[model samples]
Target chain A: MYTRILVSALFAGACAGLIAGILQLYFVQPVLLHAELYETGALSHFGAVPISAHPELPGFDLMRDGLSLIFTMLIYTGYGLILLALMSLAEDRGAVISGRSGILWGIAGFVAFHLAPGFSLPPEVPGVAAADVTVRQIWWFATVGCAAAAMWLIAFGANWMVWGLAAILLLAPHVIGAPEPEVFAGPVPTEIAALFAARAFGVGLAAWVLLGCFAGYFWQREGVYADATQSA
Target chain B: MTTMTNTRSGLRILPALFALALGGAVIALTGHVQAAALHDAAHDVRHATGFPCH
Candidate 1:
């Protein structure tokens, strides 16, 4: 069972990571590079006037691109392992682990890891300033944990009471509020920053949706689908 | 039957251990193991994807 999960996670993580890495270079990286210009003062937000023309990667920046690919794969593999572990636990409790089910799990994973944390802390451009790292980190993890539990309750609970509990769990961290910086400072203009934020969120949504589709497909393909056999 | 039950218990033990080890590696990489340039490379993606690297 462990071997099946390990291999399946590797397969799903590799494919999804590859796609995500590619997508980032195209969609996310340019915005980042643009932001960096403002960060470094190489270009002003309105300096060139034509926002459509983004800079290209330097001709020999292989090391940078290579590292991006490797990191993307590693991070996605970590996500896949967690996803598979959850499925295994669910199956032990007699829940069916199928592609369809994987889709749901994948969405939950996205919400837990991405959307939940993002609600309080949106993605930032390079030069934007904000809260202390430690406080933000603490709040982020708390949000993910609460959101994950809430999502599970909402998905599997048998009654309205459980749903009510889920709602509270979902909102508890937000109610406490995310830590804020004393002041906001950055070189990037608001318009460019807004564009970056939108693109970043859109890219995240796509990657997470693909993660669900791929995770579900790969997990189910490993014979976890339609099997009454519990391997413990 | 006793042998089958024992094997099943052993199987259960291993995946939990496997999951633990995997989880540990993840924590280490994202936490303590984050060095300078690597963290810088990862930082952008982490922040962009809403992971807490701020």
Candidate 2:
């Protein structure tokens, strides 16, 4: 069971991570690179004449971009391992696991990890004003935890009371509120920031759906093999 | 048969726990670590994935 879980997660994570990395490279990275120009004062949003017709956006560095790709794969693999473990537990409780249902699982993951926290702390671009990293990190972790528990309750809980509790869990972090900068300030333009957040969410949704599909497919395949071996 | 099933399920707990732990550590390293060098290394991704960065 352990080997099966590990193998499935690895394959699912790698495949999803590869695609997610490429998507980010194509759809998201340009926005980020443009924002960095503003951040570094290479281009200024405020009252400064334009630097040049075409400010040289940093071209591809193999090392930096390559590492980013690898790191993305590793991060998703980790997500996969955790997700698969939970799915195994659910399966033990007789919940059906499959590619069709995996999309739902992936969406739940995005909600817990991204949307829930983001409601309080929208994705930031370079030069954006922000709270201290440590405090924000704590809040982010708490939000993810609460949101995940709430999702689990919603999925498995039997009664309204349980569902009500789930609702509270989902709301608690927002009620507490996310940490904020003393004043909202940044060189990055609102348009860029908005685009960044939107693109990030879009990429995240696509990646997670793919991850869920792969995980479910691999898990079901492994289960079939296990059954065959047991019967044999 | 019931006892066998119970034993098998019971043995599953350790691996499940292990998977959770391992997965969590990787996430923390990639998404949550505060070390400057690591942060610099993962800077672009940290921002791209919306993991909160400086």
Candidate 3:
């Protein structure tokens, strides 16, 4: 049984890493590459190769740079491990298939963003100055607001009622207060910072998964092995 | 699921292993999506819970 649990976790961890790596490469990376900060020089210092300049696959404009690699590794190494933990905890075969609970916790992670104080917007493009304090703050708030709504739907439920309510709530503030770009002299590389931050979060999330997997694997294994020996 | 294809010691552990792997992949792919927002949400929840992981 101990071996069983260990094997389970290892298997899960490997799959999580592969799929997460692919998803990041295909979907998330593109969205991030288009961010304002990536266009700016903010992320250039991370490595010699610029992500925006990288050659993308046919029909896929996604660019892979240090920043994208950071995000991919963050998901593959960290978040992938966490999923292993979750699988160990579920125990039952059906639990693995029923991913509703896992998704809720995922949303909970997103909703937590509303609690942040603020963030500074980096320069827009290469050779531009950073965004002004007000612009940064507003951007932070707006982003947080949108995230809050999205997370609420995720954490609570993605049902029509929940989604509808979240949609209304999301649109309310936007109608009254649209986030306008702040007047800044240099290009605001805020998007670059956002990309980095997102990748960092992925790393942290992966850590959480790994920790859970290890704990659950050992905990279950110890109990099962003891029981098996006793029965024998 | 390939884990189940090869049996050792008459134990059907491979299927469970594959299932776990599949689940892990899903979670890894979906878990940290919209993560900045989640970070903020967690920040708020932590404060509300009075744990303060900062």
Number of the predicted model whose DockQ against the real structure is largest: 2
Q: What is the interface RMSD of each candidate, in Å?
A: 2.7, 1.0, 13.2
| Candidate 2 wrong stretches, greater than 4 Å | A48-56
Runs with alpha carbons beyond 4 Å of true place in candidate 3: A1-14, A31-77, A80-100, A113-232, B1-54
lDDT of 2 at A116: 93
Each candidate: RMSD: 4.1, 1.7, 14.1
- Give the TM-score (0 to 1) of chain B in model 3: 0.40
Give me the runs in candidate 1 sitting further than 4 Å from their true place: A45-60, A224-232, B1-17, B27-34
Error of 2 at A177 (Å): 0.5
DockQ for all models: 0.41, 0.76, 0.04
Model 1, A1-26: lDDT tens digits are 77767877787777777887777777
Sort by lDDT, top down from the best:
2, 1, 3
**Candidate 2 DockQ, CA atoms:** 0.76
Worst 10-residue lDDT window for candidate 1 chain A reads: A52-61
DockQ, 0 to 1 scale, candidate 1: 0.41
Lowest-lDDT window of 10 residues in candidate 2 chain A?
A46-55
Please provide, for model 2 over A1-232, each residue's C-alpha lDDT reduced to its tens digit, 9 standing for 90 to 100.
8988899999999999999999988888888898888888777865656444345677778988898889889988988998898888888888899988888999998898889998998877878999999899889989989998999999999999999999999999999899999997788878888999999889988998988888888999998999999999
